[model samples]
Target: MLGLVGVDVDGTLVGTDNRVREDVWAAIERGRAAGMHFAICTGRPAVGNALEYARRLDPDGWHVFQNGASIVHARTGESLSAAFPEEALPGLLNMAHERGWLLELYTDTDMAVTQPGDVARRHADLLGIPYRPQPPEALEGTVVRVQWVVPREDEGTVTATPHPGLDLHPAGSPVMRDVMFISVTRAGVNKGSALGRIAQRYGFGMDRVMMVGDGENDVTALRAVGHPVAMGNADAPAREAARYQVGHVDQGGLIGAVDLALGL
Candidate 1:
C-alpha cells in the first residue's frame, strides 16, 4: 500500500475554478482513514492559497513548492529541503528582460515581481496573494524559483529561447487559458528531485508512493513515483510519463486515481 500521495494543485486537485470539488475532499478523507498521507506538490510558492490548501488537507505532511525547490511541513512550517542557487539569477533575469516578460521571483516564504502586469494580477487573484512590486535588487535571501508570465501564444517563442543555465517548464490553468507560466529553477531541481527527498525523509520507498498530476511541469514528478497516475486532461508529455491515466479533474479524476493507488 502507498504511504504517501503527491498531488499537483492547479490541474489535478483543483478544477478551473480553483476549488476542490466535494468528491475530491471526500476521497482525501477516505485516504486519511486508510492511513495514507497527501501532499500538495506544485510549481507554486508555499504561501497564501498554496499553503492554505495543503494545510487543509494534511497539516502534518510534507508540501512541495516552487516545483520542488522548497519542501516544508504544513503544520509546523518547518523546511525539510530548499534550493536557491544565486548564480543562475542573472541569466534568468536577462532572459525575461529580453522578452519584455513579467518575472516573479520566489523565496521560500515570499514572492515578488519585477513589475506587475495583467498576468501577474491574474495570478495574484487566483492565489489570493498580493504581488509585491519590487525591484530586482530586492530579491534578497534564498530565491527558490523564478517565473516568467507570458501570453499563451508566446510560449513557443520563449521555449525556443536558449536557457543554458536554467530549467524552464510550462504551466497553465484551465480558467486562465490566455496566460502561461515559464517556471525556472536551477538545473536538476525539480518536483521529482523534491519528491525523492520527501520519500527518503519519510522512509517510504519509491514503490510506496503515488503521484497524480496533469501539466508540462508534472512530467518529471509523474515519472518519479512508482505509481504515477496521470489525469485524462494532462499534457501529452505528462500522460506519457504516467503509469496509469484516470478521468479528468472535472470527472473527479483524483478520486479515481486515489482509489487505484490504495487498491479500493
Candidate 2:
C-alpha cells in the first residue's frame, strides 16, 4: 500500500494560471479521508512556499520543502530535520547579488525577501496570495532556502553570469513557466535528502512514498519518490521523470490521479 503520498503545489495542486482548483482540493481531502498520508514535496523552501500547505492542507502530516532541505510538522511548528550548513550562505547569497536576482530567504519559522517588484507582485497575485512588503532589514533569521528571480529572456545570465564560486539553479513553476527564477542552496540539500529523512523517521520504504511535481526543481522529487507525476505543463525534466502525465492542473489532473490511486 502507498503509506504516504507527496504532492507538488504549483502545477499539480494549483493550476498553471495559479488558481487552486476546487476539485484538486476536494481530491486532497478525499485522500486524507481515505487514510492515505500526504506531504508537500516540492522545490519550494522548507518554510517558505510549503509552509502555506502545512498550515492549510498537511496539518496532519509532515512537509518536505526546499526540495527536501527541511521537514517540519505544521501544527506544532517543530522541525523534524534540517539540511544546509551555515558555511553555504555567503557563496549562495553572493551569487544572487551578483546575478541581480530577487533572493527569497526562508527558515523554519520565518521567511523574508530583500525586494518586491511589479513582476513579483503579479506572481503573488496570480497565485492568489497577499504579501506585505518588507525591507532588507527583515532578513533577521537563518535562511534555509534562497531564491533568485530572473527575466525569462535572461535565462543565460543566471546560468552563466553568477559568480562561479557559488551554487545556484533556475526554479521553474510549471504553472508559471513564462516567468523565470532560480533557487540555490548547499550541494547536498534537496528533496532527495528530505525524503531520506522522512523515510528514516517513519520507517517506511521508498515504495511507500509518492511525489507529484511540475517544475525544474521538482526533478529531485520526481526521481526520488515511488510515484512521480508530472502535470501536463511541467518543465522538461519533470515531465520526463514523471511516471504518469496527468491532465493539466486546471482540469483536475490531481483529482484524477487520486481516483486512480484509490481505485475509485
Top lDDT: which candidate number?
1
- With candidate 2 superimposed using the best TM-score fit, by how many Å does residue 42's alpha carbon deviate from the native? 2.9
Give lDDT: candidate 2, residue 244. 81
Worst 10 residues of 2 by lDDT: 161-170
Per-residue alpha-carbon lDDT of model 2 for 50-133, expressed as tens digits?
567656666857787665556877777667545346666666566656756666666655556656777667655543446655
Task: Report lDDT (CA) for all predictions.
Answer: 0.85, 0.67
- TM-score list, all predictions: 0.95, 0.84
Give the range where candidate 1 is weakest over 10 consecutive residues by summed lDDT: 80-89
Give the per-residue lDDT digits (tens) of candidate 1, residues 200-244: 878999889888999989888888889998998999999899989
Give model 2's TM-score versus the native structure.
0.84
